[model samples]
Target chain A: MSEKHHIIQVWFFVGVLLLVYGFLILASGLAEWSHPPDIVLAELHAPVWWGALMLVLGLIYCIKFLPDRKA
Target chain B: MTAMMAWTVPTTLVHLSAVDLGIIAFYFALVLGIGFYLKRFANTGEDFFLAGREMTAWVAGLAFVSANLGSLELLGWAGSAYQYGILAAHWYWIGAIPAMVFLGIVMMPFYYISKTHSVPGYLQLRYGSATSALSAVTFAIMTILMSGVNMYAMAVVMKVVLGWNINFSIWVSSLTVGIYVASGGLFSAIFNEVLQFFLIWFGALLIPILGLIETGGWKGMVARIQQNFPGQDYTHAWSTLGRFQDNPMGMHWTGIVFGLGAVQAMGYWTTDFLVVQRVLSAKDIRSAKMAPIIGSFFKMAVPLIVILPGLLGLAVLPMHLVPASSLQPGQYSYNEVLPLMLARYCGPGLLGLGITALVAGFMAGMAGNVSAFATVWTYDIYRPFLRKTAPDQHYVSMGRWCTLIGLIVSIGTAYLAMGFASIMDYVQALFGFFIAPLFGTVLLGMLWKRVSRAAGFCGLLAGTLSSVTMFTLMKLDHRWVAIFALSPKAQGLAQDMYQALWACVTCVVVTVLVTLVTKPRPDEELKGLVYALTEVAQEGHTSFLHRPLFWGITALVILAVLQIIFW
Candidate 1:
């Protein structure tokens, strides 16, 4: 693929990632508003779980969109 | 004459035997020596402002932790833990870790790529010069107010614990900091911060380990707390999983978690030049990235050292000693309660000296702020506008002069802060008034591509207005007589949670919606930001997964869950 095409693809992936995380934040807010199951709320609030999820998603997004090794 | 005489009384001790005077003079000489020793490294503007961007990860990391662990946090958290039970740990667990992670992984790359000496510099690149100048001025004002209060708190502790007069303490503390900071610039500030990191950690740890042992160990302390404050909800309160309603003292868990936690976390971790200067001064991107994350490891343990002792103090000390009456009406002064505990419990000799070192630790934190304020004002605001062309030495000299001026202004601010009834209230009010608006602008500038310069500036103004309006309403409504009498239990909790809830909701909603409606910035400027974000992954040597984002989120979730269950 051409360099221009690659840059566009990277932008597309970033857009997706932002959307997904924004959705998660919205979900978390709504979940709190709706007062979800006690177990779910408990899990949702844990820094470990939320931190892990955000990290995993962020890493995957960064790696996929902005690869370390130049082709 | 009585008040004037009261001030001079503390100065009399300065004329005491040569030995006592020597110790004070020795302290001054040592600090100045460090400043002068580091002066060679600060020959340039970059070095003076940012240590020539050569600080190692470990130094940056430790300095970051030390700078944030001010006396206010040490004293405030302890008081909070004493009043609210263990659930107060959520402040560190839920608030600090996630914020640091977000800052490191997501926000920091923008800073690294922009290569801005100040956060406002980044604003200029991404938005426009107008927004940048506005932000620089706003931040300087906020730093002056916040650092002033922090300085005042340290002076207050010295006055209460050592029986020194307040004005004398302020003068001594301010001058000691001014001399080193003005001479050394960021170099001395970072060096002193490293020393203070150890001092604060050692001082904070000494209180709890010694206090617990004195009270018969953790089990004995726990038993005493349970016995005295039965059904006080220690388990839920201490746990990381608890909600806003979980705190018995009625501190709004959500408001603190989000408002102070998320908002102030964004302000301090992302925007504040003081914290950002540490990262910007790093040897490389990897060091900058790793420093705050590693620093957070220390921050995670700070509550154990600082807050736990206050909770332990509740069990060991008398009710009158840690009396609720000491707190001003409609205000919480829990931060003051810790030093009071030290004066009562910790005997003189090495133990007293160690606690005195803790007071120094707090001073070190305030000194770091003074150094940062001077650096930002001198390099970003003053030099840019006033003296556009100058040699590196000239800028460095100006930085030193700015440091002295900054210290004097902050000392005056601290004296004024004394009029406010509660330390935490004054600190929070200042933060909310100034930073809440800036948070919106910076956050939008970083994340949203579509936010225009006009919108960014407008959103900032709107967020500030919203925050001030909410704060005013809360203050006014709090004064009106209640229609019906509520139990003391209900009243306390309501008051604790109210301010945090209003501030968070108002700031977030106003900033986001306003930015969305406003036009986007010119595409050319934003394109660079986009390219930089994409390139950031390639620039840093460390693996992406090793980023603190994963660990931070996990920790935040675990702590939040624990807080909820415990609450």
Candidate 2:
């Protein structure tokens, strides 16, 4: 593939990853909605660990696939 | 209790006079000295306003921390801890770290990529001059409102601590900041901020330490809290999710974590020129990028300095000593609690002056905000439209003039804002209403190639209007409920989180959808657009969107996980 096309694909992939991550959060919140964590854990509110994992995966994709400046 | 053991209020002004004056003089001399020392740097517009873009990351980092660490926070956070238990920390955990990292890694890169002198200048390059002007005007108005509130906070602190007339306190605090800012512009502002940061840190730490010792140490204090406030969950008190309803002290984790953390984070870290100006004024992209990261690390430690003391005060003092009204339901002005504690507890000696330094710490924060407003107006607004080709010296002179104008405007605004609940609350709510939506437009314009200027402008207008509509509706609903004798808690969680969630979502959706419909700009205009991102290049990266992108993303994930586990 051409360079421009490759760059476009990378961005598209990253967008998909973010969308998935958002969905995961929505699901977790739904699962926990009825039985809210105790006040201690409730203050945590969202699933930060899952969020962190998704963020990490997204970062890895960016590192491997995203374009760098050409000298 | 024996008469000798009973607490007695100081009956004579003579006891407080020397220490109070000494504190005032110390503050005046330090700020003024900074202003004078940096006078030569203010010989030109760039130097006066942007520090000639020569600031290192460390300087920018320190200044950024100092700018945000105002008295409101010093007072508010401590009040929060005392009232809410540990859950109050949710404010710092949820809102601060994530938001700041987003700014440093994501937004800062965009600014560096744009190579714009000011945040509004980036808007101009991406959208058009009109949009840029609108953003600048919006920021200026919001900043004025904010600085006014900050001024009020300083005035109130001074009034309560020293018994000065409110008007006199406002003038003295506002004018002292104005004089230095007017004298040396950003240079003096930064220099003074560095000094203020140290003073604020010292003062914030000292009060809690002293109070803890006086209360018979941690064990005694903990026992007192347990005995006095029964059924109070210790874990919840320290938990990040603690809500205001949970604490008799009137602070809620929801407001601190979500409201202050998410909303304030987006507003201040992303949009506020005062903080962003520190990064923009850096000598290069690397320094700019590093500033917020380092500054945020420093911000993380502030709880130790500010919050612990308030908690300590709550433990040591009797209910009779602290009036019931002061700790009334839903009326904890965390800011007032500190000075009140000091007045009640501090004895005649050097320790008294040290506590006075906490007041100075508060003043320093106010000064930073004042100077920031001055810089934004002078460089982004005045110089652009009023005098296009003015000499450097003339621009520098204008900067000083602008600083004076900012101070005067802020003082007037501060006096007007006092009737509102808490200054910090008012400022944060106002910022959410005004500035948060703008972040969406700016972020899209920088990252996406298809986002047109017209689309960006339309998106901004739509996002802002929608967010405001939602906010108004929520307020109206709350008011109606109150009229019907309904409790605030009955209004529901959605109403509370409405402003932050919708404001962020609306801005993103509007910008994206509008961009999809609009035609992209011509290729020629887009040539240099990507260069700003490229100039701050990673050596090992083979393309524009390489390792740094992933590194930033990975960092976000780690942060999220940590938040989940610890928070």
Candidate 3:
């Protein structure tokens, strides 16, 4: 019998990438929350919000495009 | 304010922390992994050059748009927005959207059905080998040179922003792109481009979003721009196009509509192999047709990210920005707007992502150009001319080898550009010489049944020669610009437009005149290549929603609405 080969989707790769970046960024944001960096609108905590958004999006992509999952 | 002023002072505008470097390292590692993983599939010539022709519409579509969305384009257009105001949006909207739509609905069928490996391959089928050879050589040279220019530009950008050594930036990035692209061919390039697309959005979308918040939305931004640059129409797109001198871009409505929107955009989207190669990888006719339509949607939205940042910078930045030639110690140049905005807003982890996005864009751009160059060099030039009887595997190996060679040549070109920055301008002008006339020749060859092969070659030659002559004269004597541009006050942009228009006109005139005297190919011989001789493939009883034309029209409707909204 021929072995079945599974090709990974580009989105899966992107998901993993974004997820890793998100985690790192979110952790950085949390560490800086007590005393934010001196930047324009740093009070808004853009890293925290944007990083969380990226994490959620990445999670969604990773789930939807998992290698074993059927479309 | 110190960070905001970093662009002018420039002691390495921003430094990446450990986490930031991690993000960039992660990006490079992932792309290389994908490239190595895809290597097994790229076994044959077609697979290497065309990604096995199994890409879905969305895959090919994102790749198509992302291939053109290189870092140079992003920074250049964003900087244009600062220099020329809202008028820069014209390049995104009227200049790109319509051509993309037309390519999907009209041109893609011929390109797809012909089953050509590259744009020059299509020319060979339509206009004979002589014409194809010219385009192949020109395209191969142009792409390699363009790739080198982009490499040098990216190195300089990194040096200015991060205090990285130019040679270190150049070698490291080029090696990454070279390794990935050489291993996986078009597949690696396309996948990286798709990822780069998302990274660009994630990294850059914040600039406009935060800028809007700071400036209190679109109306506030426009008001602030008016206050900053009084008596100038920085916020108006089409209104300033009434007179050449009325706008900062110094362009007329006719030039915008005809020269850029009609000729240049059409030539690029419909004919340029760098972008078209992405579309050509779609799995089927329908997907191929749909790819550019999908790209058009993203192309239309690009202005929001690129153009909006420039407007935002004008609305809010504290430092006075001047043109590069007039830049002083305290003032930043227009080219530094995007980097300045990144420094002003992004911190730590987010800074890494921003820098990664720029690096990804640069690598993807280089990969795209090099891959396209390799394809042309292997299939169109090397295979056809040097070794026509090579096995498919041999050609695939040749393609891989050419990728490394192209990168080496590009690295050299980058140094040439660094030594003589004006050479970059000349290379760009050289590119412009071929685009309009090639569009004319290809448009005629595909549409008009009477365009003989000889006429095609002669027309292309005449058009190219005329363009070169015109550019040379304009360079030698400034007075020639007035005659070509139809007004003494016509600026550089206007001169480019009129020059393209004239070259296209010259091409068409020579083509018709020569076709009248030459022996036209019979309809039997011309089948599947010309519009009238070829039976067009119907998108075939798919749902109305699934039709490429339906979405193409939808894109056009949105385009019209955008023009009205931004009018």
Candidate 4:
């Protein structure tokens, strides 16, 4: 049982990785908010939208599968 | 196919921003981290090859689907959608769904209950060593060659899309995949594949979403297709398949049904060890059965991302894309549809994510193939043929070494692919030679107890040789498609279908004929491997929702609805 506890679930790692990526992308989105890149539908701000979506997803995973939580 | 596409684009498509590079770097770091973290657990041969058989249905199922979601398939099918219209969805639907359901409900029990480490290992139990040896060597060669093709293809795509040098892209990706797979084995590959499943979905999903938003809706897109290419039924799946000239793919309904839906699909989803190894890692018999059923659901949804983008490209791209045959300097081919779609809608950070998704796809594809090769090499080829009495630790060490050596061979093949582009087409066709024939052999071995050992080997040999002969004839004279496919106008895709169907038919015929003359394996020796002779574990009052059959039926119903809707 202790040996089982030593193994990290794949979801937890996915969560943490998503969280870091989400933060960086979200920051990039905000940084370019006033002057968005010249491309199709720049006004819609897809980076911000997709970045926030990733953030919420990451938080849900991280909270539910926190490494130290009792199984 | 993307593998057969010659890289002729002189100009780079897009340059990655620092944020984009960072996202890709983080993904690499995380995969490597997972591999090192799992190194302690992969100490035994079982753990290395099969993840200690402890994966949940969902994990195994996602990895199972993701193993085939290579960038080559994604890009190729997406490009095919652009070129062939909604008909390309047939590959995702009828070409896949039935085979997956059959695998889960009918085949998984035999594989799981027998406790076989690999598909060839199962063959060894049913037939004698000759059949298993043929299967193992063919599978190993196919996987290694395929891994190389994917490695080279990814490097070419990177150079075309991101301005990276081909050698740099090849070495970086191959070395990364090699390190992780060698260190953590199947566990690392599965974990990364599951992650890749998410990356592919999230990264590619926006195209369809944003594309739909731009094109209005399904109805609007259909209208645009009709408006753009008038009188061309690019929006219907089955309606245009009535005649050879009716559809862009130049395929008939019979080829679509028997060749693709029945033979090729069964051959691939049911028997390919590259994907089957994931299901073999399930925690229980139920999980093993449930895995492919779960995978079918996700596979059905892939067209929303892959096929939809290509259709959108047809409806919305500013310039007309040419086919690869007529492609020239500075001209974009249909194969560039996905990357072009990525550039059209994605901005800085999101662009990075999309590019990383493609990179993840390529790397994960290479990892899955290499890992499967290592398992087949260590267990089926190396141990059985060369050193039969080695310790478990010795085998595990050999698996790791084999993983590295396999990557080196794959890298060499990648260079070979660079020199001779036509080899990719031949290799892909050679792969086709095995799948449908092997499916026939495995199916007979499982269902028919009277089949002899000699019958299995002879049937497989005859089937493979016939496929080779047909491919060679078709290459030597294009008119051979008329003879093999029974139509003068049958295209390359049609030739593939007819070839697979004939090969499967030839195999079944030869096996039955040989079985009559040869001595059969005794019933006592065929217990767990053959169908009715085996004692299957009962589910024992399990809820209907918990049963694999229930989900299999549900998936089939959904598949029927999808075909009708797209029809």
- How many residue pairs clash (N, CA or C atoms closer than 3 angstroms) in each of the candidate models, in the order given? 43, 23, 0, 0
Docking class of 1: incorrect
Q: After superposition, how far is residue B211 of candidate 4 from its true place, in Å?
A: 1.1
Could you give the candidate ranking by TM-score, starting with the highest? 4, 3, 1, 2
Candidate 3 whole-model C-alpha lDDT, 0 to 1 = 0.84
In terms of lDDT, the best-performing candidate is 4
Residues B1-567, candidate 4, lDDT per residue (tens digit)? 122223434566666677987898899999999999989988888899999888889989999999999876667678778877887788788889999999998898899998999999999889878888899998888888788777766875676677666777777788889999999999999989988888888789989988888889888888888888787777889988889999877889999899989998899899999999999999889899999999999999999989999999888888777665677777677767888888888888888888888888988889999999999988888878899997899999999998989988887776654443222233436556988899999999999999999999999889988998998899799889889987877766677888999998999999999999999988989999999798887876999989989999999999999989888
Put down candidate 2 lDDT per residue, B59-170, tens digits, no spaces.
7888877777777677656655665444445555555666676777767876866667677877877788777777788788877777776666666565555445556666
Candidate 3, residues B445-520, lDDT tens digits: the string is 9899999999999998898888889888887888998788776666655667777778888889999999999999
> Model 4: what TM-score?
0.95
lDDT (Cα) of model 2: 0.60
Model with the higher TM-score, candidate 2 or 4 = 4
* lDDT for residue B80 in candidate 3, whole number 0-100: 75
TM-score of each: 0.76, 0.75, 0.95, 0.95
Q: Residue B334, candidate 1: how far off, in angstroms?
A: 3.9
lDDT of 1 at A17: 36
lDDT of each: 0.61, 0.60, 0.84, 0.85
- Write down the C-alpha DockQ for each prediction: 0.01, 0.01, 0.49, 0.51
Query: Residue B161 lDDT in model 3?
Result: 72
- Ten contiguous residues minimizing lDDT sum, candidate 3 chain B: B1-10
